[model samples]
Each structure stands twice: as structure tokens, then as C-alpha cells.
Target: MSQDGAEFSFKKIAIPAFGPSILFGLGEGAILPVIALSARGLGASVAIAALVVTLIGIGSLLSNIPASILTDKYGERWSIVGAAGLSMVAMILCAVAPNLWVYGLGVLLIGAASAVFNLARQKYLTEAVPIQYRARALSTLGGVMRIGVFIGPFIGALAINFFQLAGAYWVGVVAVVIAGLVALSMPDLVHEGGAQSATGAPTVRSILVDRRRIFLTIGIGVLLVGAVRASRQAVLPLWAEGLGLDASTTSLIYGLSGAVDMLVFYPAGKVMDRRGRAWVAVPSMLLMGISLLLMPLTTGALGLLLVALLIGFGNGIGSGVVMTLGADYSPARGRAQFLGIWRFLADLGSFSGPALLSGLTAVISLAFGVAATGLIGLAAGAVLWYWIPRSPKTPS
Candidate 1:
């Protein structure tokens, strides 16, 4: 295949590349809205329940390095299968747990499995897709997951009507099992480059050392991008609540925003592939930043919705950018390891964004905190503009 992904038909690999991700996203979405509630049902206080929700991110953060190693050693297919199995077990445990501790464990396991599953699939696509089509393939992957997540809550609601809160976990169980089966059925593609290590496979530590420059530079922009993206979830709801909007109204606004978000992924990818990463990346950050900066000023649903839509559009267009950039910079020798670190940095920013907001809100005001986060978005756009390569690098 040519470097441009010539003669590649996305439809040919659609099932293997995107099917499992949809299932996984469905399972994850089904469970996310209910985790804190589940913990509360098991006797956790509000604070403790909230803490339990954070455990998922904590688990993912802790597991990234290990997940990378697993992917490197076992390859993407088995790792995905294994992760899916783990997810099923976690969901079942959550469904049947006697107390909050056990349920927390289940949630943590779910996160760990997610890390592995996501990393494996990303590495798989990075290897299998041609360079020219890479952005489109990855953006589609991101988009499909968003689609599944968008549809998942309705499925969970239907399940809940019949079986109550536990039904959501059951939905997760079913989703992951199907995902695992899909993964098992996928045909393995040949990776283009052989391992680079002379003595043996490079350790994650060694890969980190070798790729420190990329991590320190473009990686910082990725971190800020992640921070802004993740913060949007918290910012919108909090602002809505502050404006006296009810839960249902907030949810409707959120859903509308997500609808906008899902619409642009494919076009975004096409632009990146044809033009450059910066064309999409810089604009995405700027739009999100500008939307966030305007969010604090909204006092009505219409204003909030407009700003939220803009944020969604910005985020939507940036789909798969981080993964595409990671794949571009990845060394074929230690590709999984490199992406592992990349994901870790991004995840760290995700965690930090909320924390930063909370701290700033406590010290000043909610408006100030949110606007500060917007500034971070603008800063990220600047960094990406300066740092992102004009052309995608073919993995060495």
C-alpha cells in the first residue's frame, strides 16, 4: 500500500476496526450515568459516591502502562478480547455486589479493562490503516464510539424500566460480551515494521527515554486539549444548574450538544488527511475556547445551548486528532509503548481539568474558574499551531 492509504476501502475493515468499539462504548455509556447512584444504593454518602466515580479514571490512569505492555506482548486482538472479558466480569460483579467496596472494585476493573481495550484497538488501527486514510479511519472509530454512547442511555433506560438500576449493568454485560466476540472474529493484519530492539523488545521505560522530546513538546498541547475537552462536561452542567435549570433541561442541552459533536468527525478527518493536522486541531481548540469563554455570560437556555453547540462542534472536529498524532509520531519499534505514554498524558490532563476547576471555583467564583479553563484552551491552540507538524510523520 502507498503511504497515502491508496486503494484502501474503509468498508473492508469496518467490522474489525469499528464494531467492537461501538459495543464497548455502549457498555461504558450504559454504566457511566449510574455509577454514583449505584454506590449510593450500596450505602455510600454523596461525597463517597462521587469519589467512587473518580475511581474509574484512577484505574485507567494506573493501568495505562500495564495495558501498553499487554498490548505489546500479546498484540491487539487478544488484548481486546481479554479486556472485554474483564469488562464482563466487572459488570457482573457490579450487578451483584453486596456493598460499595465490591462495587467500587468492579468500577475500577471496568476502567482498567477500558484502558487495555482502547489501547489495543488504537494500536491495531495504527498498524493496519494506511497513512493517508489514517485520520479518516481513526475519526470514524471515534465517531462510532460517540454514536454508541449517544444511543446507549436510551437502551439503558429501556432496560431500567424492566429491571431497575441493575439493568444498566446488565446492558453493559451484554455489550461487552458481543464486543469480545467481534474481536475474536477479527482477522489479524500484518504490522509493517518489525521490532527495533537489537537485544530484545524495548521496555516502556526505554521507549519513554527515546521519545522524550515528542512527549515534552507536542504532548503538552495534547494534554491541554484533553483538559479543555473533559472540562466541558463539568462546565456545562454546573453552569446550567447555576442558572437554575432543572436536571432534565440540562440533560436535553447536553444531548443536543452531543448530537452536534457526532456530526463532524468524518469531515474533520478528511480535512486533516488532505490538508494537515493543524487545520483541524488549531480551529478545534479555538472554537472550544471561545465557546467556553462565552459560557459564563449565558443566563438563559438559548444562550447556553448556542455556546454548548459551538463547543460540541469544536470538539467534534477534533475527533481522533490525538490518536492520529500519536500514531504519526509512534516508532514502529515500540509503537504500543509510545501510545501508552501518550494516552497517559492525555488522561492525566482529563483528571486535572476537573480538579483545577474545583480549586479555582473554591478560591474565586465559578465564572472565573470556567473562563480560566477557556484560557487553557486558547493556550493549547497556540501550542498546537506552533508545534504540530505541517505533514504527518510516517512512523519510523
Candidate 2:
């Protein structure tokens, strides 16, 4: 079919394309806020409870390459279904856990399943959407996930009133089952032609070796971006507490920031498609970095809220940019494998960002640590500005 025809066809698959993502986000959001609390209830110490929360990132980090292999072998639809099934089992385990260890294990498995689910949908969309509309498509996907996450806490709060803390896990269980059902219903699209190995499927080692340059350059930028973004979460609450804000006030500020974050995605995506990736990417990092730098100076709730909104707007505008860049650079034959590596770098940054902040805070002060994170954000902006292609290179 013609390019325009194919682009129009995306509309037909829109529901199947984005539905599972929303549900997955809902499931994750429902449980994320309560994981540490649940761990504490299960007899975990403060340190152990925090460690339990990190298990999800650890699980995802370890599973990225494996998840890619699964996506490549079984295809996107089955991988998504499998991920959803795994998530359901994980949530059930969390709900019925007899000990803190069991609950932590469940959280880890949930992370691993999330890696698979995310990679599959991204790979599917990368192949199915036409190049011209790829940015908007991916951005919409990101936005919908945010929408689900934003709404999920309310549902979890209601459930908690009836079922207590475990109610969140129950909500997760229901969400993933519906997500899996939606994945099962999605129509599988045929992949376009690309070079295949004559020897057989290429090894992950070979794919990485061939794409090492991309990984080192743009991949580094991705890492920095992930670090800065993840650091935002840590900076907010810590700084709020340092300023003597109560939990309810902090939560209100966070919710408002998120509301701003959800608003700019589509416009940002449109600009990326029409202008270029750097157009949104560079400014996003800069805004977030500036906000972080300003955060250290805030002495009251109003000042903090304004900075948070700026950071949120910055982050929201950059939604789907990382995924879009991955799609653009990924080779047709080993796309999933490449994205697996790409995601690993991003997730690595995410895992380390907060750890870095904590270490810095331990050594210096909260303000110093936050300012250092802001520096990382500025560095990311510079890297992306220099490295992001002026025009996207759509891989054949």
C-alpha cells in the first residue's frame, strides 16, 4: 500500500495499539506508591523496605536483553501476552505474600514482566506506524500510559478503603488480565523486508558489536536523560520534606506537576515530526535542569510548586522522544535486540540516578545533591544537542 494509505491504517489499530499500555501503567501506578508500605507491613525495616522498591528496576535491568530475545523470537503480540500473564502472577504473589522476601520477589518479577511488555509494544509500533507519523504515534503511546498512571492512584485509594494495602495488588491483578486480553485481540502486522543473516539469527553479541558506536554516542545521551528524569522523583519529595512540607501538601504538589506533564506530549510529538528530535529534546533537558537548579533555592511551597511545574512541562514535552529515537536508529532485522540494549542503558540511568543522589546527600547536603543532579541534566542537554541528528535517519 501507499505511504499515505499505511499512515491512515494506523487509525484502525489505535485501540489495540495503545489499550494495553494504559492498563499496564494503571497496574504499575496502583502498586508503586504502596510497595514500600506493604513491605513495612510485612516486617521489613526502613532500609529493607526501600530496597524492596528498587527490586523492580533491578528486575527490569537484568531482563532487558532476555526480553528482547523473546520479542524477536515470539513476536510482539505473544510477548505482550506473556508479559501480562507474568504481571498477573506477580501481583497475585504480592497480594498473598507470607513474608517480605516473597513480596520483594513478586515486585522483581513485575519489573521483568514490564520490560517484556514495554519492548514488545515499542517494537510493534516501530514497525507498524509510518515514518512520518512515528513521533506522534509513540508520543501518544507515552501520553496514554501517563494518563493511566495519573488516574490509577485514585482507583487504588478507593480499593484501599475496602481491601486495605493489599487492595492495590488486587487492582494490579485485574488490570493486567484486561491488558493481556487486549493484547490477545491485537492484529499482527507483517514486518517489512530487511537483511537477514545467511548463517542464521544474529547473536546479541554481534548486534551490540555492530551497533556499538550508536550505543556509545546517542546511548550515552539516553543514559543521562534517564538519570535526570529519575532524579526528579527523588528531588521533589526529599526537598519538600527538607522544607518542612507535610505528606498531603507534597502529594498535592506532585499531582499538580503530573497534570502539567500530561498536557504537552502531543504538541511536542507534532513538533518532533515536523521539526526534529533536538527541537524538543534539547529544550526539555535544559528546562528540567534549570528547574532542578532552582529547586535548591526554594524556601516555600509556592516556589517548589512552580519549579515542579517547569520540570513537569519539560519532561512531558520530551515524552516518547527516547522511544522515537530508538525506532529511528534500529535496524529492521534486529530492531528488538537493539532496543533491548537501548532500554538497558536508559534503565541503568534510572536505577543509578537515585542511588547517586543518596550518595551525594550522604556526603554533602540535600541541596548539593540536587544541584549535582541538575548538572547531569545540563550535560544531557548538551550531549543530545550535539549528537541528535538534525534529521531523523529512518533505518531500512
Candidate 3:
């Protein structure tokens, strides 16, 4: 089979690039638990601790458009490599920060760099993967990312235990640098030369007008999914603590669930391609609602772990399946913009999930709030499934 009519092996280019990006994604995922713990150790308030999540979101939101512009100007590979290089710098800044504010600034930079690298690579999705199997390729991308995130935090927990936050930052920096080197080894995307052919490229003016509408539609979807998943992961430890679970227990739960996601991620992507993106999303949505709402009912560790695994499984669909579908639906001219907007909206949910959980914890209880997110996710998924229906990423 061929992608973009170029006879190629999926295992080769996609795997190499996809693998490094996974580390990048993992670093992004691991930051929260370690950093929040760092803040608490330094005597920061819970509100201040929440700032790290906000900074990351602000960084992602602020960077999206600029990152797109950079990708269009410099090409995807160089832009992604540059992003990785910047992330390395961010990790250094984070490692030595004396306070949460400085740490927030460093994380902000990390978010910006991540936004660029993520967009450049995702834009490459439509152009690089065969239309017939784009969902699968997108899923593969998600699977690798899940693996990195799965490893990063568990390793990070070790660093934090032995050496403190500095250790986690050091590891993150090294991993990011390696990711950059890996990205550097990849070829430039095919669109690097004359991607906007004169015949059909959207005029710059028209692009500005229409891209927002598409962004509007997809942004809502991203917000729904990003927030639901982020909140669950971000505050799950807090919930565990409330339930009397120990730190090691929390890590074990997170790790075990991550394993489930890792296992489900690739197969889920393959299913999306074979069965269609909608198939991956619809039932997953139903399950997400059922699983999360049941959080209040779990009687013990086994029940909590099962809920965690269910969340991962649903995410295996939404994060992996639906996100790939978004890559397909986005127009090529402003594909980066679509992604930027989509991710930026998603970041809103990502930021809010933790913050909201913290706030709600004050009023009601963490478990109740957590369950609410599942309801929101179900609502969002239903709207998207009904509205989008069955179709290609672009026109069929």
C-alpha cells in the first residue's frame, strides 16, 4: 500500500518519527504529577500548584498559531526538531527553578515547544498516511505517545523519590534532546516544496475566514475530550488520596492503567482504520460515561483500578481514534491552524480539569466531580457523533 502515492513502509518512517514524538508526549504527560508534588513539597498552596497545568495550557493556546506559521515557513521536520530543542531548554529552566512561578514559566515554554512539534507532525498525518488507512496511522501515533507517557511518569516518580524534582527535569531534558535528534533524522515532509499549488491553494484571505469555522466545530470536540481525559489523569491521584490510597498505590494504578492504554492504543487505531473513526468513538463514549459515573460506586482498589483502566480504554478511542479523525477532516491549506485551534481548545479542558477538580473538591467531593466529567464527555461525544456522522476526514 502507498501513502500520498509514494510506495513506503509504515514500519519504517512512521515508527521512527512516531517513536520520538512519543517521548515528547510522555514528557508532556509526566510533568503534572511530579511537578504538582514538587510544588507541595515547597509549601505552595493547592491553587499555586494548579498553575503548572494552567501555564501548560496557556503555553499551548498561545503557541498554536505561531507554531503553525513557523511550520509553514520552515517545513515540518525542522520545526519539530526546533520544538524539541526548545523543550530541552525548558527542562533545564524547570530543573533549577527556585519557586513555582519560575517553574511555571519553564513549563510554559515546554508547552509552546510541544505545540509546535505536535502540530507539525500531525499535519504530516494527512499528507504522509494513505487516506485509506489514515485513522490507523493516527492511532499508531497515539499508541506511541501513550507508551512514552506511560513510562515517563513511573520513571519520574522514581527520580522524584531518589533525587527530587531536579531528577525528573534532568531526565525530561535528556529525553527531549534525544527526541530532537530523532526528529532531525527524519526527512522533510513532501509538502516542504510548493505545498500550496497555484491551482487550488486557498487564497490567504479566504483561509483566514473559513479556517475559524472548521476550528469552531472541532475545537468544541477537542475541549470535550481533552478536558475529560486531562481532568481524570490530572486529579486522579488527589482522588486516590481522598480514598486513602498511598502514593505507591497511586503510581501502580496509573501505571497499570497506562499499560492497558498502551495495549489498546495500537489495536484501537487499527480498528478505527478498518471499521472507521466513528466506530472507535461511539461505543467508547458510552463506556466512558458508564465507567466514570461509576467512580462513586467503587468499593476498593480493584474497583478504582478497573475505573482507571476503563478511562484509559475510552481514551484509547477518543484520544487515539477521534483525534486521528480530526486530522483527516482538517483542510490541508490551514491544517496546522486547524490543529492549533483544536489543541488550544483542548488545552482549555486540560487546564480546567485539574483546576475544576480542585475547586469542586472544596464544595462537594473529588469523586463526584470526576464522575461529572464523564457525563460531560458523554454529552460531547454524542454531539460529535451525531453531527459528524460517517465521512472521510475531508470530503468523500
Candidate 4:
């Protein structure tokens, strides 16, 4: 309310939180690519490896609503700390697991923990950050995440060389422990108004019943976008390997793409805030679609590298766009619940995408998987083009 309080800088307030955020990203990045690879190495087929990778999304989908409920009940601090701790435990399990089934369970736990951690963090940011700066703040958060992810795989590559693929899980364990420690020691920033309804406490059923139109329309588009994005992560290493690229080169190329994505993070947010979210969302989808199409055409490392760069550029331009939009549409009352449903749809899409791709690859060919994602991306762009402009500016 006072002039001095208004001048309190986000940079100072967010530093402690940033540490955990980046570390979490690093841990996920280091371990996730290797999950599928590890599964394949453990005698699973390519399709089975993809199923293992999809478990993360499936776990997140299962946990989203529960995560929101926990955050609303307990607040961000405990939710994050507990989730980080669970992530560390899951990493340890993955490291020592004797079979693909056990490793998949660990990965599933990581995903569930991730859902809780991410929802809590997003809730905190939505409540604490000023509206004028919201997009940029979220985008910068995405950038911080991108930075760790970009750096993680390179280190993971080294770890794999020295200690084998499971070594990546060790790196993840360290990163998760560091993140949990940082988060535990940090001060909790309390916001003025908690996300509760004016009439009474809101239930997920009520929110869905009330916002069904927006949920079905723009939500579908969001789902498709999330699907394409998740497919990119799940398919890339497998695709590269299928094309005969070595592990180190694949990691390097993927890391470089992440670098490109990080570069545009802030700018993407700026564009969204200034020109409306559509400006970024539509273009990103189009670019991503083009990249997916080109992916199947890649014959070697260089060609894969080119597609990776395009996917990075596409992904970069939409940094934080999903969260920004989620915040924009969420009712201040019951924010977490709304986000829970929002993210559930997205996570469902993410799970189904890779599963669908794996099925398509098994039935037809990898090229069909690529073509399907390309088609989905293009369709998603069209949905955004039509839906975003007509949506109400304020939460109902």
C-alpha cells in the first residue's frame, strides 16, 4: 500500500525461490532423457521405452487435481519442500532400481512430485507478482528453468560416459537434494488475498461446471500445444538414435536447442504482454509444426540439428505462454483448483501424445509420428487463432 513497499524488487524477493526452481529443472533434464534410454538398455523395446517415458506425464495427470488441493490447504512452502524431498527420494530409487518396472515407478513418483511442486510455485507467482509484470516474471521463471535444462544434459553426457546411464540419476539426486535444502531454508512470502471465492469456498466441480465453455474451447488448444511440446522432449532422443546419431551428439544438439529456447524467453513474454498472448502462441505453434514435419526428413546429425534448432526457436518464443494464459483465465478465487484442471488437460495431452506417437511408430513408421504431431500443431494454432480473441479478458 505504501510507496516504499511498492518499490520492493522481485529480483531480491525471488532469488531464494529461483535457486530451487533452476535446480529442479536441472534434475529433471538430466534424468528424463535417460529414462527412455535406460529402459531400452534394460531390454525394453523402443515402444516400451516410450511407454516408460510417458509414465511421467501420466503421473502428472493423475496428481494435478490432488496437487492443487494440497497447495490450497497447506500453502506453497511446505508443498514445494515436500515435493522436492520426494523428488530426491525418487532419484535415489531410480539410481538403484534393478528392473525397468521399478525405474518406471520412480519416474512416476518424480512426475507426481513435479506436479505438486510446479502448481505450488505457479500459485505463489500468480498471487505475489503484480499484474503489470506478471508475464515477464513468468517468462523469466521459464528462462531460469531453460538455463538449467540447457546445461544439464551436457553434464549428464559426461556422467553417462564415466558411470553409465544410471549416473544421470545420481546427478539428479544431488540436484534434488540441493533444491530441497535451498527451499527449506528460504523464507515464505505471504500474499494478501488467498485464492478463495467471495460467496464461499469453491470446489473443482463448481469451477468446471461454471467455466465449461472456456475449458472445452481454449482448453483443447492448450492440450494440443502441451502434447506437441511433450512429444518433442520424448521423441527427440529416440528419433536421433533411430537416425543413427550417437548419444553424445544427440545430447549436444538438444542442449544447443535449449540454449536457443532460453535466448528468447524474456522476449516472448514481452511480446505476449504487449501484443496479446496470441502474438506468441500462434507463431510458436506454426513454427513447432514446421519443425515436427522437418524432423522426419532429417537423415543425419546435421539435419536433426537443424530441426532441433527450429523446435527450440518455436519453444523459446512461447516461453511461459501457457502459465501466463493460465493465470490470465484463472479466477482469483480458487486459483489453484482452476490451474489444476487447466494443467490436467495439458498433462493428459502430453501423456497421450507420446503414447500416440509410439503406437503410430510401431504400426506405421516414425515418419507418421512426426507427421501426426505436425498436423496437431497446425490444428492447435488454428484453434488459438479463433479462440483467444473471443475469450473474455477477465475471469468470470
Give Cα-based local distance difference scores for all models: 0.91, 0.91, 0.72, 0.83
Model 1 worst lDDT window (10 residues): 1-10
TM-score of each: 0.97, 0.97, 0.88, 0.87
lDDT of 2 by residue, 76-168 (tens): 999999999999999999999999888989999999999999999998888777788888889989999999888888899899999999899
* lDDT string, candidate 4, 124-150, tens digits: 776666665667778887788878876
Model 2 residue runs over 4 Å out of place are 1-9, 193-199
- Worst window of 10 by summed lDDT in candidate 3: 387-396
**Candidate 3 lDDT tens digits, 1-396:** 125536656876765569677879767665656777766666778978766656767888789778877887787878988998999888888888887777778989988997898888877765776776677777777778777876787677787778777788877887888888888877655543264565655443465577666556655766776667777776557667778898889889977777776777666676666666777776667677777788778767888899888877777765565457557666656666656666666667777766676677679877778778778778767866775557455432
Could you give candidate 1's per-residue lDDT for residues 140-200 as a string of tens digits? 9999999988888889989999998999999999999999999997767666555445557
The count of residue-pair clashes in candidate 1 stands at 0
Comparison by lDDT, 2 against 3, better one? 2
Candidate 1 positional error at 258, Å: 0.3
Report per-prediction Cα RMSD to one decimal.
Answer: 1.4, 1.5, 3.1, 3.3
